[model samples]
Each structure stands twice: as structure tokens, then as C-alpha cells.
Target chain A: MRNLIWIGFWGLFVLHQDFWYWNDATLCFGFLPIGLAWHVGFSLACSLFWMAAMKFAWPEEIEAWAAESTER
Target chain B: MEYLSFYIVVGYLALLIVLGLVSKFYSRGTSADFFVVSRTVGPVLLLLSVFGTTMTGFALVGSTGKAYTSGIGVYGLMASWAGLMHSVVFFIVGIRLWAIGKKYGYLTQCEFFRERFASPALAYLLFVILVLLVIPYLLVGVISAGKFLQGATIGMFPDLFGLPPLVLPDGTERQHPLHGSIPPEWGGLLICLVVLFYVFVGGLRGAVWANAFQTVVFMVCGVLAFYLISQRLGGFARATEMVAISPFASNRLVREGNMTQLYFLSYGLIPLSVGMFPHLFQHWLTARSAKSFRLTVIGHPVFVMIVWLPCILIGVWGAAYLGPLATGQNPNMILGRMVKELVDSQILSGLVTAGVLAAIMSSLDSQFVCLGTMFTSDIVLRLSRRTYSDEQKIMLGRIFIVAVVAVTYGLSLLLKDVALVFDLGIWCFSGFAGLFPIVFAALYWRRTTKAGAIAATLAVAVSWSILFYRDMLSDKPPGSDELTLFGVLPVTAIFLLSVLAIVVVSLITSPPSANTLRKFFPDERLSRR
Candidate 1:
């Protein structure tokens, strides 16, 4: 399982290089050049938003984390 | 320029004082609130706070300076984000760390390490390293402010030494000319004072909140600076075209043996440093959730893309624009050089200058707080076993902050090279990178005994010690860099070596007591096997 996680995690690391090259000016969002900052920024924002929404929406995990809260 | 200099520095100081006082309302009650802001730091502020420290004058002034001098190569600093989050085992395996830290009431990295490893000697050793390493980081902030402020305010104070001829504040032809070709002692002192004021009054919480505020200033200002500069060059396309056409841009990474090795090695080295930087992880532990941790990290690559593109642009811009100076001498002055050449508004220049100083102070103050608190929480408290009153310890923390600042400033004063200045940050971070495996394994793996932890700590210490001895005994620069051998970015080598040592020793040694294992890994033990 740890090995699987390692593979999954670091595989993403390789993918990240594509996301984070010095210049990916070839990128085309429709007819426009989204520009490097906007392209990278909006994508990251959308991904984080979706993931966060999913986490908060999960009833069981929310309840469990709530139960664990302030116990310290 | 004189009036503008006074207004910028003085006005900014007053605003910070007021902001510091206003933040005092948040500082009331329990030391926890005072130190960690009740861990109420939200995502934006948390991001900013982390950026505040992480980006610093080094990122703004030093790295840009390097970019100006070194061609597009230093932009690799930005490409470094992919590895930054890889080092974030504390966020993943570190859910266990939060539980343990809360349970034991441990604060700072060394405190947690000492208790978990159950070794006093290890704790002391770690604390000394933390103190030594933090000095360089603090200097990044101090030295950057010195350079920027001096350049920005040069003619304002021309005849202080009873000399008749005043050196005009020229944006002399380097990459970041404001970065005093000579280290500016007074500017370092002034910047140090601003950092000391808030950090002294409010401690870590104050430092972090200010960092949070400053992060935005640096990031936005950074983007704006690049955007404006690129506009002049007709944006990145023209900029990259300019660099590609320039003769100075090296194909060294492709052709040279050392550069090839370094390019790959940097991925591992930088990841380890980012993973274990005590300041970055402190933010990780304070997060609202593990999912939040994940989401926050998603921003890193994007942030890297945003932040570094400009730097590479700036570096190449410097390489192309610097003309005669490109043959020899530092190119890191590109941003400052360009600012003088391109940015003309008095208010705009002042704001930009302030933003640059904020970047330095933000990073420096937090680093100081981290170093001070680490010493107080980890070393002092460990040796005394929490013998001192909380108040006494807080005082000790403040004193440590002041002491570390003085030492780092002294070093920056002594060493005036751009390579040396930037090297300080990398050197400290590399030392901490060696500790990451032990930190993560202790958090996640139940079989990771105290013996394993002890072995890991000692292994890293001795390994680095041998490297250090080699530095002293041998004439050649250590490690494998085309520029110089043993150039202090050996993250992959260190991580693999440490991981192998810990796993082998753990396998040979008695496993951790069940109680100890339970204390760390908890609910997952049943799920594991």
C-alpha cells in the first residue's frame, strides 16, 4: 500500500513538471493565450476548490473530524 | 529622492507599528494565542504567512540578482516547486505528528524530535544545527533589505563619512544593482530593527501575521514588476526570444557533466529542504484539515510557475541588457537595474521598494522566530524538562531571536558575495533535509523505534560532519557542481543515505515498545497489518 502511494504520489511529481515548466507558451485555451500566470493560477484554484468542496461535502469524514475536534 | 526615502522608510515603520499594536488585540490571553494565534490562521493568511517567510528578500532581491547575473539557469529556483511539496511528509505522515505534539504539548521541530526519539543528546544536537542554520536565512532578509534600501536611498545620505565627493545612486550596470555590490551595514541594521520591533513585542504570532500581510505585497508586487517589465519587452515571447538569441545563455545543462548531474540532483535536494524547513511545516501543522493541506499544496506548482517565470524573464533580460558586464561579475541586479531604468513614478518606486523590503523582513522575522522558538522549545525546554516558567521561556525565545539576528548579520557583513549569500539559505535547508525521513517515519510507521530515530539522527549528523570535515581539510569545493564541487545542494544523496541507514538499523534493532508505537501511529496500527 505504501509502495502504491509512493508510485501514485511521485508519478504526480513527474506530471507536475508539465504543469510547471519555465515557459509553456504553446498553451491555447480556445483561441486565446490564457497567459502563463492566468493558466497556471486558474487551474490550481479550480482543482483546489473542487477537492475542498468534495472533502467538506463528505458526511462521514466531516462527522468524524468534528468528533475528533477540540479533544486535544 | 531624499524626502521619498525618509517618507517610505519612516512612514512604513509607523504603519507597521500601528498594525503591530492593532494586532495586539488578537494577542491577548493564553501563550498559545500569543505564540500560534490560537492556530486560527486561515488559508489566505496562512499562504501569505508562509510566503512572507519563504519568498523573502532572497526570493525578491537575491534570487532576482542571481537571475540577472546567471542567465536563465537560476530560474531553476522556481521550477523547484515540484519538489517542495514532496518534502511535505509532515502534512501526510504528519497527522500523527500533530496528534503527538498536541498530546505531549511539544512545540517546534526539535522538541517533537527529542521526545519522540527519547534522546536528550539528539535534541541538543538538533537545536545547535537549527540555531546555526537559521542565521543564514535571517541574513537573507537582512542583506536583501540592505541592498535594496541602499540603492533606493543612495543619494539621500551621501556625505556621512566626512568625504567630499558623494557617489551618485546610479542603478549601476549589474543585474540587481541595489544589492550593494558592497554589503550595506546600515541598511541591514535598519531592516533588522523593523523585524526586531514586532517580533520582540508580539513573538511568533506577531511575526507570522506580519509575514502573512507582507506575502501579498511581495507576490503581487513581484507579478506587477514582471508584467510591467515584460510589457516593455512585448511580454514573455519577446523576452524568451531575446534570451535565446543572446550569446550568453548557456547550453551547459545539456552539454556539461556537472550541470547534468546538478539539474537532476537539485530536484531531490530542493524537495528535501522544502519538506523539512521548520517554518514551512509549522504552517502545515496549523492547517484546518489534511484535505486543506492537500488543496493548499495544489497552489505550489502554480505559484512556482507564476513567481519563477518573471525571474527567468528578469534573469535573461539582465543577461541581454547588461551587455558589457555579462562577460564577468554578478547578474542578480536585473530587477533593481530594470526598476531604475523602467519604473519612474516616485510613489510607484517607493511602494516597490517597500514591497521589496517587506519581502526581506517578512522572511527574516519568521525565520528568526522559528530559530528562537526552536531553541527555546526544543533545546532549553528539553534540557530543563520544562523546568522554567512559560514567561521565562518566552523571554529566552526573544533573546535567542536577537542573538541569532546579530550572528547572521555579522556573517552577511563578513561574506559579501551573491553566491555566498544565497548559499547560506541552501546550506541550512540541506541540513534539515537530512532529518525528514526520521521525522516522517516516526510519525507514520509503528515499527520505527526510538532506536531507529536515534540511529537516523546520528547517521545524518555524522554524514554531514564528514562532509564538513572534507570542506575544511580539502582545498576543492565539496560535492559535485560544475561551478565548484560539493556545492551544498546534495538532497537526493542525503535522503537516500539517511533512509537506508534508518531502515537497516530499525530492522536489526528491537522494535518500538507497543505503547510508544501506539502513541504515534494510533488508529492506523490495526489497519496496517
Candidate 2:
């Protein structure tokens, strides 16, 4: 799941830039929208993705750890 | 040189001092207050402050020097692109770091990383590397400001003090001195006074509030300087032609240039360490919402567009005029010389110089504040598990701040080879690039064990220590080819190798106890964070 989110983040980064400075890379393979709206939306997706990752990675870990420590 | 702009400089200086002192009352008040502005930095001001901090006078001076030599290579332009693109990561990873920091009440990136990775050892390692590498970046800005000061107040202060004549680059082969000779320390002292004034008072919060104003001052002044110099030297088209015709014997366009690739790619790696920076983590923590973090990044590209245009030209102009003159001088000083030569008035030169100082000092405070907090709070106090009164913690932090500045100041004076800094920085980040994956996993992947985090982090740290500065490990100075390899291959290899190592190790390792996950990612903590 972390890998998936990481992939998504890097993928978005690759798509956003106009790094086609060279003629060989001039293929206009547009992936996302242009301008501020696109920027805002893309960031939202990333934010959500990270939030979900945190929760998934440490599911109940906080509470469970707290309880165990208290018992000890 | 006209003396009218001296008023602008004086007014701006007064404003900077007033702004710093006033912010003491208004900026955040606690440890968290000092570090993260209570996570309540607003948009307009936050935008300005962040931009001001990101690009410094080095952008003004050194980049101009590169442009002066390289002509109008796109490398100069890439600063904005890199800066703007940095936001995309901020929008993505930034919110995660912020939310986590808020949840844990973490003051520094080290604390967050320690919690997330369940590896306090690795966190300490990171803190040290961050402080060390970031010092060079800070000093780059300081040195640039110093150069600007030495040039700007040449005539006016002579009568007032022991100032001397400047070797005007007026087709003269002679070297001259300014009012008394202003060295790097004196200029550094001025920069330190202004930056320390605000940062000590308001901390990051004050810096945040003041940066917005400084950002405007830096940018408008930078663009104005670029424009005046470009026109004085000849228009942009002719400037390009001069670059095309001159000794820029390389066939690469700025976009296609060899260094360009390194710069753009190196910039992309900036985000790799962004989640790990103490200052940025502070900003992330204070965020009202993940939305703020996202907005910071999304809004970044626009700032890139606005700031990069004028800045790239300064470099271009400097490259054209001073390419031959950059014998022993720092490439970054190209713009400073151009400014000194092109401007007619002492006042305008002084105002522009003040703006340059503002740019450099702005970059310095964030690092000073962030690193100081990390050293004092996370490493010293947290490691000792000593609960300090607020005043004590603040005092510890202040001492660390002075300590960091003093050491970095000494380095700026003693150490000349700055490229070593970028090398060390990349090396340090690469040491922990392995943790970046784990950080992502902690945010998302539930199966990630602390053991797995430890395994990959150690593997990469060891690997980076060897690979990142492998050339420096040798007896001989690195050849261009070897430097090029280090520039691209080794760092890239470490980044990739670390990710791979983490995945393999995590699969082999015992799963993190469910309890660990629960405490690390408690559902009830949603609104709390």
C-alpha cells in the first residue's frame, strides 16, 4: 500500500512537468490538467493518499500499544 | 552613485527591525509556538515566507554568476522550476508529516521520524546530517549578502567612516577597496543582526510573518536589478547572442546542458528530504488542515513563474558581462559585480543591497530556528527525557541557535570549497532515503515493521556514507567525469537501492505488533491531529 501511494506520488510528479526540453523527449504526453485548479486537485489526491497510508500502516497500533504499555 | 536610495535602505532596515520586534508579541508563544507558529501561519504570509526562505541571495549572486559565465543557459531558470515543483511533494508528503507532527506534538522532523520508524537511533543520525548539510546552504546565502553589502555602500560611508574606493568594473584593470574593507564577517554580522533580531523574538512565527514582506522586497528588487542590468548591458536578445558567440564552448542548451540535468534532478530529490526537514515539519504541523500543505505546494509553481523570470536574467547578464572576469571570484558573485557596475546611484545600490541581504537572511533564520529546536529539544532534552520549564527549553534552544550560527559562521570564514556542501547534503539525505519509503509505508502500509524500518535505514545510511561522497574518499581531487558520476549515478543508486532494500527486508522481518499500529495511527486521534 505504501508502495502504491509512493508510485502514485512519483507518477503525478512525472506527469506534471514539461521536461521535454530535448527534441527526443518532445512527445506531448499530457497526463493531467494545467493551471491552478489542476495543481490544487492533484495535491488533494496526494494528501488523501498519505492520510490513508498512515492509518493503514498503523491500524489500531496507537491504541493497542497504549494498552499494552499501561498493562506493563 | 546617487545617494537617494540610502533612504530606501534605511527605511527598509528600520522596517525589518520593527517587524521582528513587533512579531515577538504576535507570533506563537510556546516551544511549539517558537518552532511551528502554533501551526496557524496564514496563506498570503506563509506563501511569501516560504518563497523567501527557499530562494536566497545566492540565487541573486551565485546564479547570476553562473548565468554570467554560461550565458542564458536554462540552468538559471531551473531554480524556479525546482522550487515550484517542490510544492507538489509538499502537497503530497507535506500534509502527512504535518498531521503526524501535530498528532505526536513533535517539534522537529527527527521526532516524527523516530516515532514513525520506531528507530530513535536513526533519528539522531538524521538530525546531525541535516544540521551539517543545511549550514552550507545557509552560508551560501550569507556569503552572497556579504558580497552585496561590500559593493553597495561604497561611497556614502567613506565620509562617515573609513570607507575607501571601489574597483569599478569600468574597463579598469586595477583593483580597489571600499570605505574600510568590509570582509565576510562584517557583512555576516549585519545579516545576523537583522535575521537574529526577528527570529530570536518571534522564532519561526516571527520569521514567517516577516518573510512575506521580505519575499516581496527580495523579488521586486531582484527583478528590478535584473532588468536594469540586462538593459544596461544590452537587451535580452543581444545578451543571448553574446552567450551564443562567447566562450560557452559547450554544445548543450541550458535545458540540455549537463549541469542542467544534475540541477533539475537534484531539485526533484529535494522533496525526498523535505519530509525530513525540521523547519518544514514545523510548518507542516501548524497547518490548519492538510489542505494548507497541499495549497502551499500547488501555489508554489506560480511563485516559480513569477520569481524565476527576473532571476534567470540576472544570471544571464552576469554570464555575459563577467564570464571572463570570474577567474578566482565566486561564480555567485557575478550579479553583485554587475549591480555595482551598472547602478549609478548609491541610494539605489544600497536599497538593492538591503534587499539582497533580506533574501539571504530570510533563508538563514528558518534553518537556524528549525535546527536549533531539533538539537535542543529532540536530541538533547528528548534523549535525556528531562522535562524542562518553558523558559529553560527556550534558553536551551537559544543557545543551540547561537551555537549553530557560530559554527556555520566559522565555516564560512575558513572553508572555501562550497560544492562540498551540496555533495554532503545529497550524501546525508541519501543516507536516509531508505527511510523515505518507510515514512510512506507508515503513512499507508500497515505491515511495515519497526525492524524493517531499521533494517533499510541502516543499510542505506551505511551505503550512502560510502557512495554519496565516494570521490571525496579518494586521495586525488575528483575529475570532472568522477564528479559527474557522483553528481548523478551514486546518489541515484543509493535512492533506488535503499527502496529495494527496505522492501526485501520488510518482507523478511516480523510484522509490527498490532498494538504499535494502534498507538501510531489511532482512529480517535483523527480530529486531534
Candidate 3:
């Protein structure tokens, strides 16, 4: 899961380029331009991916070190 | 009624001062408390403070102006990339830096670098570079505030404040009925004084509390401004359709001409500047725990989208509503002009203008506080012979904040005529982004030598200076035929040069001492994991 989360992060970076939609002027859902709408979805995906990364991939050791230092 | 918006903005400033005074009562009166709030900030305040500080006038005023000229493609060029990348930086760089800062009692990035590389030279070098980069960043806020105020309050005090027609630097005569009404210089000065007052008294705690509050105000006001403008121009769909169908602006609806793929890809590097921002570094150190970053990391992209989407749309709609702007017309004022012309209610317009001020001032306070922290903790305390009490340290910080605010305001005045808020902002971020390679290497690579870091720093500084000088000489209009390296922004080239310098120099020079490695990269095998 941690590895996959990392992969998703890199994937999103590449996907954000959105070369295909660059010239498209078609409005998505009657308002948003296609390129703009694609990114809106991309931003939402990034939010969810980050949430998952925090839950599954966070390095617990650093938190433990910080807490122990505070205790001292 | 003419001064209603200005009065509401004044009311908001008063509220911030009250909040500052209130925060002083809660402050612990220690240097630690004043600088980082003793690292007691929780998740919610942390989220808002970080977001507020990051979303400066650049996000609101500069962005709208850019979108007006460049079209909806502007969103893809920056907003979406920023949404995904800013959180990435926060997670990857911010968390580790916070843990190290808390453990070693680091109050500023200079302090951390000084200790990590065992080189005060690097720290001093970094201090100069960071301050230079930050001044223009500070100017972005000042310029935006001035332009917004001047643009919004036009015709309000025409008789009292209007000036005789004077030729601008661009050789255009003052065209508006209220040419000098609430001049940009006065607006910028007023914001500087208000922000300095709160940051001086309240310290980091005051700044954070105010940031959270201002974040709410600006977001609400932003949405209201968006909705009201859209309604006035027919609904959102209709406004966009109008822009799409208009012969003068139909090109704005699509990605063509100057919105090249290479140009868009280069913007991805710009958001990395946040990783190296001194203000952001200070904010990270104030987190209660690593868990505290969870909310900020997850919520930042969403917050960015919320603020940016509306501002971009408004700018796109401006192309149709405003028609062809005069060649010398400032785009920074487009959003302000839109609100003034479209939003009919004086009360609503006042609140919306105040909201724009809220976004601009939120960043000013944070940057002010961070500069003070760097001066007091990183430079003065480190170099002083005599020890000082917490109160004295706080006193020195407050004094320096005043000095920085004064210097920034003076610079803003000199550059007010020529600076495009968005262009100036991109240049500032480019300088910082070029330095990102050093920060990343410092945190992750145990073998990174002091010489290598210095070499990389010099690469960024030299490349950025030359590029900025060339861009200025070109004197081309924004987003059209400015200096580029291989058709992408000079930032991409500068970043690559820094990376190359770091790698080659680190391989050639001896690595950092084992003690230093143990300290910064403890559990080296598991560092990446």
C-alpha cells in the first residue's frame, strides 16, 4: 500500500500534464472547460491519495522520536 | 456611500488589531512562544495558517489578471499543478523538517542549515539569498493591495483625491475619472502598517489566529464575489458561453498560443518553491505533532482549488465583460474593477473588497513574522556576545519587523509603476524553486557536502540573476515572448543546473562528517522508508 501510494503520487504528477486536453474547448458539465475540469478531478484525486498516504505510509518512527524528546 | 468599501476594509483592519491585542494576553511572553507559539498549534489552526500564508495576493489578484489576459488555460498552467505539488512538498519536506526543528530547537531555516552542515558561511549565504528572494515576494502582496484598493475605490473620492492628468511611465495619461483616488502607494502603506501592528504585538500566535480568521473571510468573500459577478453577467454557464462566443475572447476559452505544453510543464517546478520558503518553514515548526500536518497536507490542495477556480473563472469572464483592455492597462485591477462594476450592493462590494484585503494581509503578517524570526534567532542571537532574556529577544524581533515592513513598503512604491504582480511573483518563486535542490539534498542525502551545497546555492543564484536581468531587459509584455530556455521557463533550466552542480560537487568533495550524518540522517537505512 505504501509503495502504491508513492506510485500514485508520481502518476498524478505525470497525469497533470494533460497534453491531450490542452486544445479542447468543450465545456464539461455545461460550464468548466475540458482541460480545467480534468484538473479539478485531478486535484480531488490528489487529496484522496494524500489522505491514504498519511494513513498507510507515514513514518511512525519520527513521531515516536518527537514524542520521546518532548517527554524528556 | 462612496467610501463604504474603504470603510469596511478599515473595519476589518481594526478587527485584526483587536485580535492581535487579544492574542498578546494568551501569549506566554517567551521567545519560543513569540516565534513558534512554543509549537502548540493544533491541526485546524495549522491548516488555515499554512493555507492562508501560502495563498497570497498572487493567488487572488495576480491570478485573475493573468487569467483575464491568458484565458482559462491559465488554470492548467498553474492552479492544478500547484494543487498537486504544494501538498507533495508539505508532506515530503515539511514533516521531516518539523521533527528535526523540534528536536534540535531550531527557530529558523538558517539555524538548521548552520547546524546541519556545520557551516555558518552557508547559513549567512542562505540568509542573504532568502531575504533577497523574499523582498520581491513581499512586494507582490504590497503591489496587489495597492492596485486592488486603487481600482476598487475609483470615483469614490474623485473630487478630493483625483489628480490632474499625469503621464504614466508607459506614456499613457491618467485615464480614469479618479486618477489618484486612494493611490496605490497609500493603499500599500495602509496594509503595511496594519499588518506590522498585529505581527509586532501578537507574534506567531497572533499571526496564526488572524490567518485562520482571514482564511474564512477571504474564501467566503471570494465565493460571493464569484457568484455575484456571474449572476450579473448571466449565470456561470452563460458567462463562460459569452466569452466562448465573443470574437475578441473566444481564443481565451482554449489552450493556444503561449499556453504551450513545455510552458505548462515548467510551472510544475514553480510550486516547489514552497518547500524552501522561510515563512513556510516557520509555520511547519509550529505544528503540535507530525499528526498535525495530516490535516494541512490533505486539505491544502482542496483549499487551493476552492480559491483558485473561482478567481480563474472570474478572470476568464473579464475578457468578455471588459472587452479589449488598453495596452498599458494593469490586469491586477481586473477583479477589483469587476466587483465594483457588477456587484450592485455597496455593503456586499465592501465585504468583498475586504476579503481581497484579507488574503493579501494574511500573507504579509506571516512573512513579516518570519523575517523577524530569522533576524532575531538566526542572525542577532547567534552573533551576539551577551545573552538576552526572552522579552529582549522578542523586542529585537518586533523592532526588525518594523524595519522590514518599512523597507518593503518603500520598495513597493518605487516599483509600483512597472511591476506586474503575477510576473514579479513568478520570478520570486523561480529563485526559490532553483534553491529547492539544496533543501531536498540536505534532508535526504547523507553524503551531501558543505562545498556541494554552496556550489548548488551559487548555481541557483547566478543562473536566476542572469535570467531575471535578461527578462527585465527584454521588457516584453507578460506571457508573451519573455526569456525562455528551450521554450520553457528559465526556472526549469535553473533547477536542472542546481541539481547538476550539487551532484558533481558532492561526488568530488569529501562527504559530511559521520557525526553530522548521524544527527540529521539517523536511521539512514530507513530514512526513505
Backbone Cα, N, C clashes tallied per candidate? 16, 38, 0
Error of 2 at B288 (Å): 2.5
Give the candidates in order of DockQ, highest first.
3, 1, 2
**TM-score of candidate 3 versus the correct structure, residues matched by position:** 0.94
lDDT of candidate 1 over B1-529, digit per residue (tens): 5357458656776777666666766675455554556555666665566655566565666666655554343444345443245324433543444445545555677777665666677667766666666666676667767766766764554345122343457934333323222237877887777777787777767777787677666677778887777777776666556655566642211113212334544544554555567766565555454444444444554555555666555755666656546455545566767766766555556667777888778777777777777766666765674477666767788798888778877887876456456555655666677877887787666667667777777777777666654433346645633222354345555666788878888888888666565445546434455
Q: What's the best-to-worst order under TM-score?
A: 3, 1, 2
lDDT per residue, candidate 1, A15-47, as tens digits? Answer: 434334333333233211223334344335434
Candidate 3 lDDT, tens digit per residue, B1-529?
Answer: 7677778878988999999999899999999889999999999999999999988876777789999889887887788888888898998899999988998888899998898889999999999999998988898888878877876777777676777786889999866666646988988998888888788898999999999999999998888889989999889899999888888877887787747888889989999999999999999999999999999989988898898899999998998889888876878778877987887777777887888889988888989999988998888899899999988999999999999999999988888987454477778889999999999999998888899999999999999988888886556776765677887999999999999999999999998987788677746624545
Provide the overall lDDT of each model, using Cα atoms, as 2-decimal numbers: 0.59, 0.60, 0.87
Compute fnat per model.
0.05, 0.04, 0.69
Model 1: CA > 4 A from native: A1-8, A16-72, B1-6, B66-77, B80-90, B93-96, B161-183, B249-262, B288-295, B324-328, B385-390, B410-421, B468-474, B477-489, B525-529
Share of native C-alpha contacts between chains A and B (below 8 angstroms) recovered by candidate 1:
0.05
Task: Report the lDDT of model 1 for residue B136.
Answer: 68
Q: How would you encode candidate 2's per-residue C-alpha lDDT over B1-529 as one tens digit per residue?
A: 3565656776887797898888887854577777787777666666677667666665565555555454333432345335434664465466556656666567877776676667778677767666655776676666656656666655555544463345555855442455543555677677777777787877887778777788888778877876677677676555545544555422222444434445446545544655555566666665655545434565565565455546555665455455556345666556666777776656557657777777777778888888788788777798676688777777788888888777777776665335554335344444444446656666667777666666666666676667644555555554553433445545566666667766777888877666567556645344345
Evaluate model 2: give its TM-score: 0.78
What's the true lDDT of residue B490 in model 3? 94
Q: Worst 10-residue stretch by lDDT in candidate 3 chain B? A: B520-529
